[model samples]
Target: MNKSTYKNQIKIITNKNQKEIRIDKFLKNYIQNISRNQIQKWTTSGKILVNKNIVKKNYKIKPLDFVEIEISIPSVLDHLEYKNITAEKINLDILYEDEDVLVVNKPAGMVVHPGFGNETGTLIHGIKYHLTNSNLNNFNLYRCGLVHRLDKDTSGLLVFAKNEYSQKHLFQQFYSRTIQRKYIALIWGNLIEEKGTITGFIGRDPKNRKKMTILKQENQEFNKGKFSVTHYKVLERFKYLTYVSCNIKTGKTHQIRAHFKHLGHPLFHDSIYGGNRIFMKKKCSNQNIEFLNTCLKILQRQALHAISLSFIHPRNGKCHFLCPIPEDFKTVLENCRNMFLQ
Candidate 1:
């Protein structure tokens, strides 16, 4: 490949012609922070080859069979450094905390981390500020104490990285796709199904950086996002709305909202995808309009909440955690019910 087209290449050598090392395993030894899937992609795309022959990722290494591959990825150096991260002791609702982890109830309208247009006053920034000059700093900046994240508009439980060891292990759980995350949401339709799953490929819209699209051609570039899935159960159905409890199997940006919207339903009060007067009026009684107005006043963002989170502790080998619903969400539900009563 042209030097301008490819970044770096690696050649693999082995002792004897052996079915010993799976092609992907042989690759991990050489590449740091790279996954087996990447190697397989390289193989499929003609980037990784054995003895100058294109092979599947399962190809075993032979004594003199050479493996050549090219890969390009951004360096961690491109990420923000710890020193540059100033912590702020912003009002964090610490639901659970210990020597190893911290679970906090994050409110809506709060960015979990500074990204996009949001540059400061994020959860990470605040945690960094609070943990400054403490044992937490012993770890890296990107993971001072965060395992996963909720969207800026989605309120609920978030586990933070308190140290480096926990950070790595926790991240491993998320990457391995084993983390259990559940959300509660008020949606704009009367969903008849009690439980079901939504699956789609989610990627950023080239036309709008702020949005993601589920439909894209196979083998497309970065514009094509990852496979996302959400399993949802209708907890309660209001006149024109439904409350859904969702367990996210694959966490992607706006997975719940996007999936529901794809099926002709968006979350309540969702500005981007939600219908304004249409859905809002469906659930509202004559009096619901007044109550919804009050609910809207308290709800700064979307009507979604991460009410629960459970995962195995990466260290001690035990199951752990459930964060309660935020007061604002509870208030919305209560008020929504009260509106229906009227």
Candidate 2:
């Protein structure tokens, strides 16, 4: 990858309406190449500087604020790339770095690994391009230094082990459910209770086998599902929306999305779980109904983020880390500031 491509920016002329808006949002609308989630991560890690200050991604902009952003593309991924592999040199936000591990904030749209339609430019490929041949065991399915995997659309703090011992120790901790994984999500409706926990058996939905579901009492007895647990507290409420902090004890497939759905309060953009479709419907008024079918494709993913992760350093026994909140989620959360006063 070319190191020279890492340093750059374009003038974002903002009018009065957007003068005080967050920096992360501006990039998403102006820079088509990058996603909002990526900008959010960079903001949290102090990668995206405004006038050379390490401002929070949620910092409101002033009129004519000259924003100078320095995004370092992942470096020297010699092992992850070959003669034919095309890896996009996208910038990754490194929260904390050391010889033993790297805590990075992953973006919402990035697929974690190569798959059916996304064989190129995945998080795995990005890692390989930046830190070639990471300390990963052959048995680790997600590869690279990835000890654990996050859903492609969920943005937030993820750990990457720099060596074999750290990888194994972190892996075992996650397997035993010792690591704390917390998330912030905006779901439809004002969740009445302040905080609570949700526990149930989760299995593949028989009708739509691709998705996971919380089995009912009758089906739980003989279910092939795993036990799932989530603890959450409502942060604030929008008109018909609620921002919540979700802590997962057992990381099953689609646990956050499915569990919230089972609560009758699916995430705002989770279309499969009966999330708001009219929001997209209103955004696509000019198109024909046939074209409209896929017109709202951009809004299919939910607004969720991984904000914090705390765990013991398996090898060193240090209190490892707690990653900051991604900016996009902050932007969404900031929208509910009025809710607290009301």
Candidate 3:
């Protein structure tokens, strides 16, 4: 669920002046980071439709015609050989575990899975070690029963399925928006509203491929990014910082971070979104600057922790999982409070 669900759908309404183009070529130009081969595969598999009817890859587009492309893209693990992932022994903060699921408190700075430049020392490697050593046959070697993901720098509760059936069931809950996820974050500025919702279309930043941005109306014309929503409530407010609770309505990449940033209050220490720098200060003095630097060092990452997660157990349907904030995050909050009090 860490990956955005909107990547599956590509909808377009042809402009009045739109020229006739092959459906595959049109899609390749419409969607960013998508290849023509992938578009053809989706078309051939009947995942592409024109005006509500399935179309061939070479189908010609027409003005005022509607096109909807549905893609069932495979997970990253599907492309990697299971044997390539080494099960490294690492200590995991187990929150809860059962025959069908496992809940763990993932620490900050831990990658959820191995990918391109990161091929080891990830949560997946540790999970593999734990499951294999425990002699559990429930997890697949590739995904290790993980159905969702957290960013490398985010710390908090994470749930993992124990089997294929449980994985599908849990994934469906996330896809359907039945799973509840609440995160605690210390942001850079005081929000004007105590509680509010942010709604925008989230897409990869054209300037920076590694970052996500809230698309403006003019920007949405061609990109048509996924719609994302997040609700936030202020818990405590300081002169320069605000503690808030964020509940995500859509699990897009960097949803919470991007939403908060769009509100002019990025999560504290979020270097990627420009929160690592000081946005507020009691006074422009060397002491204030030193204090802010110290706080940055203490946080080291985005000040976001997945404090709560509630989802029905895929097996029994009666089980729910929850976890408290981790110590590191709490310590940072306490330190910030003390600094403000002084």
TM-score (all chains, Cα) for each model:
0.73, 0.63, 0.76
Model 1 clash count equals 6
Clashes of 2: 1
Worst 10 residues of 1 by lDDT: 1-10
User: What C-alpha lDDT values do all the predictions have?
Assistant: 0.70, 0.66, 0.78
Model 3 stretches with alpha carbons more than 4 Å out: 1-81, 137-144, 220-224, 281-286
- Which rank order by lDDT, best down to worst? 3, 1, 2
Report the number of the highest-TM-score candidate: 3
In model 3, the clashing pairs are: none
Q: How much is the lDDT of residue 193 in candidate 2?
A: 89
What TM-score does candidate 1 get on C-alpha atoms?
0.73
Please write out the lDDT profile of model 3 over residues 1-342, one tens digit for every residue: 232122345567888987797887666655544677888998888888899999888899999988887665454345335466788999999988877789998998899979888889999889888887876655555443676679999998899876555665676566556688899999987789999999877888888878888987587433446667788999988667899998987788898998898889999989999999998654547776787788788778999999888898976665555677766677778877887766
Per-residue lDDT, model 3, residue 56, is 83
Pairs with backbone N, CA or C atoms under 3 Å apart (clashes), candidate 2: 77-129
What ordering of candidates by TM-score runs from best to worst?
Answer: 3, 1, 2
